[model samples]
Target: MAPRTYGGLAFIAEVYLGSPSIRQYLHVDTGSNLTWTQCFPSSHSFVDHIYPKYSPEDSNTYFDAECETTAKNSTPKFTYYASTGVCSYELTYGDGNLIRGRLAEEMITLQTRNGEFKVVYDVYFGCNDQAVGNQYIGTGILGLGTGKFSIVEKLGSKFSICFGLIMESKPTHNLILGDGANIQGHPTVINTTQGNYMIMLEFILVGAELKALDDPVQVHLDTGTTICHLSGFLFNFIV
Candidate 1:
């Protein structure tokens, strides 16, 4: 995996999708819940034309939830476009970027240590027809959050990622999923509430001074964000 620079921020991973298998460099966003890409009929959007657009018609394993009755009868539920009556999605990012498209399921290929493997899963991804803003520099985003539509949640309940320092010349990183994510670490048990991984931060230590927080602060661990965000009071205290 290589680091892709976007508006001064860097992201990792280049995922291969569909039967023909188009490679797309995407943001490995742990804070997001859905994985999507620019698809056919998205000429209006300012997408990278260098990469080929994904065509549902090209992949035999591709299934559209709206058009196919069998797909609609499947276990997973899908949202529909009000006017078109097609299964669709509309997403608005934190940076004010927006995307509108239909939902689809297709085969995904992954490169593993053993070898390359293919998995046919019900991938709930948007086939973007419209996109706004320059926040997205790559083909799409790889959602690693805890939502049902997230890749981690859909495949399994396990995933691990190691971030590299920006100053490193050739930074090394790892993105392990499923059984491969069985590596050990300094473990801390946390609760999952409101579709987020939350931890209680009791206090902080600066130099030799120990600062105890009045109340335990709830912090969300997000890989999508580049920097840590602190409350005004916490910032002042830390400063």
Candidate 2:
């Protein structure tokens, strides 16, 4: 993973998938739960084919995740395939962008910058074949949200992600999973809002001046989301 692209703060990770392990660059998103990547020969797509797509047929470790439930009830964010027994999903972002894919399980390999290896087997993820927005910088997204199918849950109960200076000569990484992560700092509870990470904002201070925000606002911490959004009243009050 590295720095954000252009005006956005996007850090992509080097993740290997399947038996032989095909390399893929995935943008890290703490706001999402499902780790998804673009797949080859897409039946439908609007974004230009800029990056190479992942072929599931090539991966011997890939397996389709069947729908456990009997009924196929289509929702605004998810869909089920009863005929194929495949669990498919559709996610609508804040910007109204949709990412549609099929759920599957595959072996994953995480290689650190220091040549370290951490392999996790049977990790659930989405094989995206269709999209509606610009794919941006990576082949797909690496969801790090605190969800059932997230990388954080796959690792351990507690984890810490460190973002150091973006100097290539001085590469630094201290990603700790489990009890090894130091929990000494003044910690605040993180709430899950709309399947994403959220926190209550009390007030805004600019150069020691406290800004007025009548009520506490729910602020989402999304690494994948590049833009900052503020309510009209909050925006005017702050300025």
Candidate 3:
């Protein structure tokens, strides 16, 4: 499905969660690994005007890790709140944005080419009650990363995104999850030891000048990072 854009910086998608479902617009962040949304009874959060807060108590399938139990002999595998016995998480962005809350599980609703459907996966998502930073254009982030707790890994480890160019008029981009991604391209494969998507850069060509690098540099393909960063030597040579 195509995601809505704001100021050509943030991409937003309409996502539904829980039983009975609460629809929310969230930022589509390929650089992140955890999906989270502001929940009701928010105490330290910046109010989001576009979508309503999610209340886990309203859903029958919602299970707070701190207050519930999993199968016998099986401990909750993800991070949790030691004080409350609930799974909890705290995210601190480079820009000083922070979100802290409990980790929970619930059914996620999606609309695919086959039509709308609901998948009851044991998703590890944050239910944030405290969020602080710049005013977010969307309610949450839809993390598309390689981490074990990421939505991609939880949903079987395959997804695709086709970014459309931004224009004067509002434009949208494609985000496909699961088996129907249908990515068409000549793939350049690289192996990595990190959780985030990383690729090796051999060299860079500017105009007609081929600037070769002394050594290959590993760069991260991050959707959440707005600006491209290069080493001092590369940046100086390029400019």
Candidate 4:
């Protein structure tokens, strides 16, 4: 759909955690969970995988979680956008890579319905590439969106997480977490169905111009989806 509005909730540039002594960067994604990272492997760690060591000395926010082995395997069980959810989480992003590790009890900063607070939980923090520099968003993801395991889903009440996207030439756009506060006044077109967690949407294009259809089409608005897509037939006509 042709998005309107330039500002709502801004993408979090930085997030803090742990005592004043230790903290780290993390990427907030609404997609998947099973938070993991690379840590010092004991005799149990596989020798085949390339594990980037996490050292407390180098990072100001590094702290010991006293983690124990939950499970281990050659490949991850979870899958998001082609990456497996092996015990050792191996993820290849566009420019950086991540290696999965175990979760430990440590403090993490997250925003809730009440406000922002630090909560101690196990996090995956091991697969950082040294060449990628400080690409970490803040220790791990702040999974929000409508996904099953999102941080927001785990919350007891209704709350929201905002995601912002930058347009090529036009102004930026903000995707709301709850009812979409930015588009509050605008005419919000939504499609709902049974047994589905998401609302479907269809952008109406008439002639050579893009516009909302008199009757919006069916679509799934999934925060977990990496990109917005249209069917081949519809796409060709729209373009």
Model 3 C-alpha lDDT per residue in residues 3-69, reported as the tens digit of each score: 3445576666777888878887778777777788888877876754545667888887888754343
Model 1: per-residue Cα lDDT over 46-161, one tens digit each: 66656556777777777765544324332224576568767866677777887877777766776665767656466766667788877676777777777756778666779877
Q: Which residues of candidate 1, in runs, are more than 4 Å off?
A: 3-8, 50-52, 66-79, 82-85, 205-210
Per-prediction TM-score: 0.82, 0.81, 0.84, 0.46
lDDT of 2: 0.72
Clashes of 4: 25
* Model 4, CA-based lDDT: 0.38
Note the residue pairs that clash in candidate 2. 4-10
Q: Alpha carbon lDDT of residue 70, candidate 2?
A: 16
lDDT of 2 by residue, 1-239 (tens): 54334223466676888878878777777877778888776876543444445789988889987656312432224556788777888888777677888888899997644679878888878888888866445778788887667767777756666766645534454555555666656787788865668888888998899876678888888878767888897788777
lDDT of each: 0.70, 0.72, 0.72, 0.38
RMSD of each: 4.0, 3.7, 4.0, 9.7
- Summarize candidate 4's per-residue lDDT along 88-169 as a digit string, tens digits: 3344443354444433333445433455554534333333222132343333444443333333434431443343343434
Full ranking by lDDT: 2, 3, 1, 4
Task: Quote the lDDT for 232 in model 4.
Answer: 76
Cα lDDT for residue 206, candidate 1: 86
